[model samples]
Target: MSVVQAMDLGLTFPAGDGDVVALKDVNLTIGKGEFVSFIGPSGCGKTTFLRAIADLEKPTSGTLSVNGQTPEEARRARAYGYVFQAAALYPWRTIEKNVALPLEIMGYGQAQQHERVRATLELVNLTGFEKKYPWQLSGGMQQRASIARALSFDADLLLMDEPFGALDEIVRDHLNSELLKLWDRTGKTICFVTHSIPEAVYLSTRIVVMSPRPGRVTDVIESTLPRERPLDIRETPEFLEIAARVRDGLRAGHSYEEEHV
Candidate 1:
């Protein structure tokens, strides 16, 4: 079954003189249990497309569905969890409370909320820090807590918008490995948006390359690497080849934009 399906999708923001096209003619299908990453230059509508799936941004034209339902319908059904670029955790809440906030709002009982929060925190390796506040944790640790919050509800689909974009290299690398384990353990369909080609290639089963401004899918490259990827796999020829293809796709998109402008 397809977790997400987008057909000729387009989104435009109204500007004073003329409208700004954020996404145009995007066609993609993300199947169940797939790890798909969107890679493109800044302002390429990667996050816009993600928001469209989350029903946060309504498409101007074409159709988008989540789990065979309209984005709005799916969102109302709590079909997915979204993690933003920043952790977005509330500073006032302890780690467990932060994870349980959604459950609390959703009317989950205290016992259910506590159990879900505990399981999610363990999944993100935040078990022992349940009493800490957001401000008390390091950047990477705080991000992991954010992820635990998203996973607390056990949503079948996960939408991550550059969740590690701000972390230092070592921390980012560590989280990337942990994220893979989390994906493996949970079997959630993931749609991640990122600017780094290597990071996209490393994390995604398939990489969707997009153009600038009026973002369009220029290419969708499938990875041949095993699902069990080590950071060092990046140094291998297969990894390099996929990264090169992504680079070529990005460069081609830029060249097209330059010529048309």
Candidate 2:
């Protein structure tokens, strides 16, 4: 089953000058268990599209559905989990308590919450740091805890908005590998947004490249690399080839914008 489907979807924000188009003519389908990445220049509506999927923003036109339901319905049903760019953990909450927040809100019994929290923290390799506060953990570990919070409810679709973008290269590389392993183990569908071409090429089963403003998908490149990608794969010829195509797609978008504007 398709995890997400969008058809001619468009969104525009109200502005005093004029209506600003954020996304235009975006049509795509994400199948179950696929890791799809959206890579484009900043202000390209990658996060906007993700927000629309999460029901944080209403579209101005066209249609979008998550797990065969409207975004509103899907959101109310808790159909997916979202991880943001920052590890937005509450500083006062311990790692395990942060992970358990959702379950508590859902009124899960204390026992179930404990079990889920324990399992998710372990999944993110944070088993030994359950009592640590967010400020006490390193940036990478804090982000892992954020991921655990997202996964605490076991939602089948994960919407991640550049969750590792702020980390140092070494830490980001490590988290990228860990994320892939988590995806493999959970078989959850992921929609990721990133600005880095190398990160998109390395992590995605398919990469969707969008244009500048009024974001439209310019290209959707299917990765030829194997699922079990190591950190060194980024240096391989095949990987570089895919990254080049993504770069070309970005350039094409800029060119189109320049000519038309």
Q: What TM-score goes with each of the models?
A: 0.98, 0.98
Clashes of each: 0, 0
User: Which pairs clash in model 2?
Assistant: none
- Model-by-model lDDT, in order? 0.94, 0.95
Best by lDDT: 2
lDDT of 2 at 141: 98
Residue lDDT tens for model 1, 142-216:
999999988899899999999999999999999998999889988999999999888999999999999886778
Task: Give the least accurate 10-residue stretch of model 1, judged by summed lDDT.
Answer: 209-218
Give one digit per residue, the lDDT tens place, for model 2 in 68-163: 999999999999999999999999899999999999998899999999999999999999999999999999999999999999999999999999
With a 3 Å backbone cut-off (N, CA, C), the pairs that clash in candidate 1 are none
Candidate 1's clash total is 0
